[model samples]
Target: MKNLDLFDPRSVMDSDFSLNVSGGDSDFGFAFNDSNFSDRILRIEIMDDAPENRPDSEGCTSIADWARHRKRRREDIKKESVLDLTACPEEQILNCDQPDMEDCGDCGNPDEEAVAMSEESPSGDEAGNSNDSCWSMDSSTVVRVKTLHISSPILAAKSPFFYKLFSNGMRESEQRHVTLRINASEEAALMELLNFMYSNTLSVTAAPALLDVLMAADKFEVASCMRYCSRLLRNMPMTPESALLYLELPSSVLMGDAVQPLTDTAKQYLAARYKDFTKLQEEMMALPLAGVEAVLSSDDLQVPSEDAVYDFVLRWAKAQYPKVEERREILGARLARFIRFPHMSCRKLKKVLTCNDFDHDVSTKLVVEALFFKAEAPHRQRILAAEESATFNRRYIERAYKYRPVKVVEFELPRQQCVVFLDLKREECVNLFPSGRVYSQAFHLGGQGFFLSAHCNMDQQSSFHCFGLFLGMQEKGSVTFAVDYEFAARSKPTEEFVSKYKGNYTFTGGKAVGYRNLFGIPWTSFMAEDSLYFINGVLHLRAELTIRH
Candidate 1:
């Protein structure tokens, strides 16, 4: 009998099983308690659904459905895993070595050959016969291929063309692959060229290398690439050695379209590094006038430094005789009329007369003709004035002002006068009394006029009196008077007046003692209207005058 423990799985499996077995075997001797028999009879039934047959309405639903879904998924994975085999090599089956298999009769293996065939041939002739003479000579003369040791992977990847040309197999006569060979002297150049070819980058760190690359590009007929290298060199400061080397190159090489930009570059380099641009200057001088002109006309070559540029121009100008002559002739014609004589033999004048030596004596004639053509009235007048003034003489001065005024009167008077009179009646004293009489007088006189007066006293003690007057006119034709008065003893009379007045006047006088008289005449009545005159005593004297009307 076994006691089954539910906690123990192995015990549970080993326990006996029945429908309702009680404590122990019954009295009827059923033998139901036989553990071995129960164990043999007991079959535990586990009724779990198979994975495919499980209820899966919420998941896979059915076995066929799940199989089809899995098959489709597998097909998708296979499709994804499949590789494009177009570029891939076809698969080959490899034979395995089998030690037990016998070689067939037709096989060439030594061990598989028939015994008779093996015995017939000596020295393993089935394998192959060796000619001792051939083997000995071949062993003695055989040449081994030397292995190439590439130091750099970068170099290994270079064009095979260069590799073959540089390899040990190359012969001297067959070494035309590279533009130039890489000797120790040319190694820098080769590296620079390789660097440019590989990466299209210039190595500025090594100036010599960069220059070598330039030379290589030039030697290889890579003009565009050469131009690019030249541009790089141009941006850097060129040493004097380089400048001289550049100057020695043919002008055509530097002046080509591809290298046109380099022409200015070389010029700038020469200008900066070379104290004397004799080489470049010589080359420039050798160019034709037209070619030189073209170079000079280039905007890049137009240097602003006046002395340097002028020196260049002067050299060019001296070299070109025809242009200078043409310019001289043009300038001569322009200046021929302006230059004066006696100095005509001077440089300026002689150049004009020569007319740039165009014609033998025609230049002199042209000068004369120009002088004649330029001889207008005003110019002639100036010439005459100059000639006349060349010498100083009083006669010349007089002749110069002959028509001008000799003496001009800035002030003058008109000749005219007014008069008034008072007469004494009969029984009045016949003898005039001029004693203590204040004469009041006014007159309008113009042109030329004068006053005259004479009087005597009745008493012996009385004095004699005399008067004279002159008149002048203003700009508006108003007249003024100037008076002169004289007094003397009655016994002796003098014509001279005692006092004289000269001004514009108005007259006022009181009663006359005996008789008083005033009278005047038009200045024109007594004097010529155009007369120039002065007064002497009581009369006017005339001088020469001309009246317009």
Candidate 2:
């Protein structure tokens, strides 16, 4: 049994479980009602469920045997330490250790005096003080964790878990000592947990046991422990392949955003590796369904074609059922809907059906049908019926058919500029020029010259041409750069306009300027769908330039 209150309410509240004792030796020796101190009340505990804490009838160690063991163990320690961790240094206690001792502090209540000193801590803030209270516990109020000594008031103050335990009427409230049996898993992390409780210091070297420490913190409801553990995991020199283990952490251990660091690390790694077929093997196949869902839903997953998605799905399915050949179809029925069948390359679709024995009837039929209906073929692409699966499945089926990788690589523009299409309402020569905010290059098409420009002076124009939009490139004098650009017709360029640049242009300024009637579609095309080209006083322009060439 260890005593010295590990007084840290923050550490206690953050963990899901902890070993604790209520009143210290002094708090319990207050000479309460002798009649009420019956067997039921006297039965102390290490933990409520500990073998020694339960009674003999419950098949725990018999009370006599448990008592003998404690006596033997107590004898192994100093006679003074028999009652608690504080027993070894009782001379300084405010007259509470001896039965006839009188209080020495100004406060009448022993507990209040102790609480007051701790509330106004004597260390941490002042390092020069040789008598830092953090190091010198009032021997009568110490918590003994194996060999480690901790201050009771400091532990109680920082940990809600310890505060409630030491509060009156709790099962352990009257007990003088409580022993914590650190499990095998927490063996390496116990010191780390203690360091944070005592001084709010956690060594970065504890990264190896972060998961173990995090789980222990979760059990003890030690939120700070969880946070520091999560911080350590976040700061690790992490890699995608190494994050595989993090992805496998039991959901129970993912406490209070404690696993957020690991989660973020795994997401970045998985998204980056989503395209690598070999990388998906072994580790990826071992990922549980939730991990699979995470990778499947991300836009950052960079596979060359959806076939890679199909290939990995099959690989993961096979890995999951290495010995159970018959389980493939069953598993596929549950997971195959994530595969975007119509988006795969023809060769990939054929490879999957020919090489893999696992059969997904609907998925196979969808891919086979997609193969025959490619644009150059005789049939139109067919979609999975909504009735056949979930809404996600139907949506993916449609997305697979419509998905188009950008023709031009997109890059971020240094800044945004608005171009009003109302300026292009003119029947001809609907000319607009760059505001010089975005630089431009000199180029020509149809024997006519053009320059890359952004929308400007639109707010000043009451009525103007509906189509004079120049969306790509930034030039410096003679060099004309080719840039991937996009445009949107907006009522007002709101913050969301950047993400919704729906039309694209990728052209070498001088030679590819034939289609340079920026957004080459005629004004009548937009007039028919008037809402797209006009709103409020004048339509606002939004665009982005990506990939300078």
Best by TM-score: 2
Encode model 1's per-residue lDDT on 1-549: one tens digit a residue: 222111221122223421111112212122222222111111111112223322211144332343343333433223221122222213101001112112323222222212221111223341132222111112111111111111111221222222222232313212211112112223345445544533445554343444445554554334434566677656766544444434333323432554556556655554443233343677666544333433433223323222233345445545654476654453244322222222111223345454333344645765564344334332343355356455531111111110111111112223222322211111111222333222211212234322222233222222323222222222223432233222111111232222212222332222111212111222222233332221221121111111111
Question: Which candidate number has the best lDDT?
Answer: 2
TM-score (all chains, Cα) for each model:
0.22, 0.40
Q: What is the alpha-carbon lDDT for the whole of candidate 1?
A: 0.30
Alpha carbon lDDT at 442, candidate 2: 28
Which 10-residue window in model 1 sums to the lowest lDDT?
A: 399-408
Candidate 1 residues lying further than 4 Å off, grouped into runs, are: 1-184, 238-258, 268-549
Per-residue accuracy of model 2 over 64-118 as CA lDDT, tens digit each: 3323433343332232111222332322111111111022232223232222111
What is the Cα-based lDDT of residue 98 in candidate 1? 14
